[model samples]
Target: MTATVAIDSYFTPVPDEIEAIDLVVEGALPPELNGRYLRNGPNPKPGAPPAHPFVEPGMVHGVRLKDGAALWYRNRWVRTSLFTESATRVRPDGSLDLAACHANTHVIEHAGRTFALVESGLPYELSLDLDTVGPCDFQGRLTTAMTAHPKADPVTGDLHFFGYGVRPPFLTYHRLSASGELVQSVPVEVPGPTMMHDFAITEDYLVWMDLPVVFERTELGVPYRWSDSYGARLGLMPRKGGPVRWFEIEPCYVFHVGNARQDAAGRVVLDAVRYDRATFRNEWDLAAGKEKTGSVPGQMLHRWTLDPRTGVRSEQQLDDWSLEFPTLNENLVGLQNRFLYLVGGGSVVKFDTVNGERGVHRLPDGAKPGEAVFVPAENARAEDDGWLLTIVSNRIAGTADLLVLDATDVAARPVATVHLPRWVPSGFHGSWVPESVVR
Candidate 1:
């Protein structure tokens, strides 16, 4: 059986529609190209798409979006000559320029009037705004592929990014000024060379979840697969800046980023989904006469809390079925209260983060959800009192659309649906930004 579920519903592409922006949605290294000798060879499975496509790229790697407008990253380039915008690419200064950027599993944002973290290095703050998409050093070496979902401190306005240190795979944090300068850089120990994914931060601490270890071999054997032998840890790195500490978990239970909040008891609460491996085995060496096989558990969704001062923590598993991804929406109902949301096999759930209470609603048959955003309710008194924006692709139709849900009563029908002109490939992650803050 496949590790990840198949895409049940996918939307159709519009061949004649004018394509505006392109983003990097998912990544993978196909089997034929990942072996010890051959870097990129012919497909091992003829006519079948590789497990990972981001490792090898096609032309037109990056997508450009203007202020307040967001685009989905399609692993493949969507080309169109028809236009509301110019077909010939131009620089931020309106000069004729042709450049392609390959940004897989990284954050792309326009903030503080001008600046962008395009490639996975120091974020280059620009002098121009969204209209002036400035030049970026496309060839810069990355210490670690920058993870998406960067958080800006509400108190200090400092943007924090989590990355892997290249020479050796250690987790590192880079703080950027509002002006886009790399103000500080610090290294944190994460036991293994965690992949470019699986790291997060809150007001007081940086959180690194169970990440995959990159072996000495250059080949990444499986797409989006983590080890069953190495134990996964819930690690914490202080924002004030200090040593990294890890809390262990049974290996094979993978973690994904959700909403994080501090509780009244001085503990930080994280909502993460953990999945069990499909296979497991313990092997014994004849000479050593010892046994060692990593344990892979069944799928579980859990809420974990950790105290930095005392290093104490607790965990509570929620759903019996799989809970793939969970996101926290603060102040959706009100700034004082917060809600936790997640997408599973065929449903979306909204729960009270403080308590464990929640509401569940299923989606239309065959609709695969991408990232989500919280839009304020149309009016204060409306049912559910908030809007949940999700991008779902329909399998039969082969088309993707924006689905607006009622957060208060998620089971309630969709309030609005924005149909896009083409299919949007699945994306790893994304977040929302208010229009007022764009300028």
Candidate 2:
């Protein structure tokens, strides 16, 4: 018999759904930090190893905070149609049911509703308490899958996102009004089925990454592989959704975008963590438990400036350190922001975009912190005037801590550390829903 694959640190699913009440807090919790911090990630069934991390079913882990206290911690698997059915189900047309998605990539709140999102299917709505509500199709308007990384304009409250598939009409842009109505869905022309994980939005334009990572037909895991023949390009389309102008760039893959905005000269500036073709493929294979040869290059914080009028593009690396899961203050989305928060290199780093300096909150040896979620202070005045919440797992101690750091001074010690009952595996994107928004 084939030996069972050993579970990686991230693929170790919790044995049971757990709830720990009245968690011990080490430091003082910020009074304004009132609400829930929910993060979604893949957690496969026990003894059922998935072909890849991305295909595992989604489980959401969350922590509730109010009145400067850690109220409770809870985790639940998102119940999609895929999780409920016993037999293999497919549509009559041969297309997989998008509603049956794992809903594992991200957890976000918009228009008073919380949604767990995966790029391959419709979003699964969850209750404020982190319980799965059901799959939401935006009142039957969203025919295509919703992106995991949807940007909500801080000024207009409008949500902007897009979805890509393996077939023709491969990409489509979506817009939702502040009131939660699906206002528009426009089909965008692209060359082929590229794995467009995340995009960016500036004040006047929406940026699209059409890299060389193309989807191929395979019987096993995710069928995406790096293609040299498929060129790398970026598409700039007006915010109002019109014609798109494309510009070629050096081949690279960006899993997440820090922020984007237009400079004084009307050039579009974009910041993200970039991985080269070889690094991207090797990492992909490593995540799938496949052996790879050669050293794996790290993802660097990179920037690109595009001048639409002259069709000139400039690229540069912002830092030498490796990082991923970059986030900025939501209030500064689509606008000029001075700081970017990221997780990698065994710590949570605050990058000063303006001064090119960095502040880091390094985890203890043998501990790893997940993506840092920024919780803005009530009536905040400055961009970094908030708290950064992240789940730190101590592999040696077999425990985890909900770490809260002052956004303004991340390098200092954590303001509060909530001791968790169990260790939580590293996961994807999360959101901090204020109490007012929950109500």
Candidate 3:
């Protein structure tokens, strides 16, 4: 038998939560940026054995900014059933507890309410001060797990997302109103169960990636694995409800979508990072603390254009940089977006679709940065007229800092830097909730 190696210390979690006020700041923080930057990720409790990266409990780190000052920095666990009770979702009657979630994937605010979300369970409500308010099922209307990558339509204010399980009704599409009411739930038909991490959106449709990664039952627990026979496809579901139109695309996996849009000609274009079979397996094994079999290729930006009228699909490689955690201005969620941001090779990369230029902001030595979240400037005119917010952690010094850079020129010096009081483990996704939105 082969022994598994230990998880990488690249992102070590701090044992306890802490808070600090009036943190030291470098450079000028935009006074207009009066909000909180909250991030969530996997963090096992102290003395807990290392488990699969995704199985760890969820923790959120937040930094508040107001009137050009870094007001406070706080980190808190979601206090889910997993955290507080060490409970299992499986009941004695074999029913599943949808609320027994780690709530570790992302944090966002909608309709004056904030939620900590995971892909496999109900979203956990959170207070403005980062306290857990308990599990929320939209007043008993939500019967399915919610996707952490929900997209709020800037024009209509509808939140679009989906959930997948191993049983019947594998994939279900859902939508929430601007006031945070559950309005629509439709079962989406897929040939088989696959790991659908994220999806995309356009003006008139929602883009779905049915890739090669399929679910498999393992001895320990059921997990998704790459399958050559499962095939690959991209489907288009109308917002008003109708039959889905799926297009055949090359077999690949996309964990994140940068942005997507549809033209008047019924042509849809999606930009995201693609990983082949070997690359994904390498990543999967690494997260499991297993030895790599061979060289692991990097993830690159790929563009897919599907034309429904002619039943044709064209694809291209957009960039060679290894990337992840793609993000853009939320206001342009389903619209034509010119600027997209991602992090790779210890830098924040900004891509301009019109000019075909890549702007990069490389971090200092030994400092690793998380996703570069785009926050649009007040009364912003240009697509890149915003700030790029990220948490930069130094593995060597056991420290973390909040970095704010000008979106127009990512390679430029940061607009502000807030020195955090504790070492924040690298996290998944978060939101920049303006004070007005949550108030």
Candidate 4:
């Protein structure tokens, strides 16, 4: 047999992106927030290798599929083999293993081909041949930190990922080759070493929130912390390198980093959710006025825009509800380009930002919407004719199904449903991984 290339062993450092910036935003975490649990959960121990089952379908929490498959990333708690055995629920004989679950998402594209996946908490790129159940790692660790919520640029086809890290704390980045190799990586500078909660990137820039506070491992072995600001500020970085501009979000704790979209006016508008004083809480049993925990009742959407030319930012409040996860389907843009979308609390509302009004569309009763994938009407119409893909799980059903809805009419109903054989727990992040893009 011919010798295989030792990609992982070769360590040639490549200079990274042209522009980058760290921004501090105002935001505090309540006990109930998702990040707190990852740090302070009872189990910190890693687990065994994952078992890729033939029948047990996969679902990603914070990832979306561009073609039809979803990029699912698991934490350390749910062991991989366990994920294979009892996908929908925990088994009595099943033990929880963190290591097996702590992996990036892999794509099993058509014709038994497997594409590599790069995710947080991993040192190197993950090359998974799902058909043969073989896995490989690329050279040098791309991220020593646990990256969170990576979004793929539909146009550039680059995977943009960001998240929390330690060791004087830093943000890490790796630009992957089409073959899924770690072509470049470097220490990405963020303002204040603030824990980057989540980030979204479009063709132009990377938008994220930096909360000031190093995460501490709780006595119970759970990682947790209290941010300096009840809210964090928003910042922007060109896909390249430069001085990062940090923007302050007034009157609200901009805890969660949402979507960054550009309007017809060439202005960039960032859509996110902020938990005010009433909605913020604390936990960790830490003393000295630090007993805040649990999320408040309602959540709202806040939009901020910056002039591309002058870098001047203008802010506005878009909509208020129990609104959590916000997605804008800018498939068509005209004077009346309607943004077809949905919220975390389960309302499908269309917003005409140009007009400044909202049209509400409700999902089928009892269908809980998680992170939704908006297949622009243009893309959806070309391949699948026209259908929006979404993963919805019902408590009673104990399963997550890939549901497709008509992009034009949110109230129309699901066009097709691919029932996932396993139960994917209520998760925080997810994305759409299209098959055509993967090699």
Please provide, for model 3 over 1-439, each residue's C-alpha lDDT reduced to its tens digit, 9 standing for 90 to 100: 1112232365577778888899999999999999999999988899987677676789999999999999999899999987898778878899889888789899999898999999888999999889999998888988888888999999999888888877768899999999999988899999988889899889888999999989896432437789989899999888778888999888999988988898778799998889988888887777666788877788888899988678788999888777889899988987889888999768888987767689999997667899888999999999889999999877766678899999998999999999898677788888898999885
User: What TM-score, computed on C-alpha atoms, does each candidate reach?
Assistant: 0.66, 0.96, 0.96, 0.61
Evaluate residue 299 in candidate 4 and report its C-alpha lDDT on the 0 to 100 scale: 56
Predicted candidate 2 versus true structure: per-residue lDDT over 270-312, tens digit per residue: 9999999887977887777778868777888999999989999
The positional error of residue 25 in candidate 1, measured at the CA in angstroms, is 25
Return the candidate ranking by TM-score, descending.
3, 2, 1, 4
Q: Which pairs clash inside model 2?
A: none
Candidate 1 structure, TM-score to reference: 0.66
Estimate every model's Cα lDDT from 0 to 1. Answer: 0.47, 0.86, 0.87, 0.43
Model 4 scores worst on lDDT over the 10 consecutive residues at: 33-42
Give the distance in Å from residue 273's predicted Cα in candidate 1 to where it truly belongs. Answer: 1.2
Model 1 CA deviation exceeding 4 Å by range: 1-17, 20-101, 106-144, 210-213, 216-225, 252-255, 279-299, 330-337, 377-385
Question: On a 0 to 100 scale, what is the lDDT of residue 164 in model 1?
Answer: 58
Who is ahead in TM-score, 3 or 4? 3
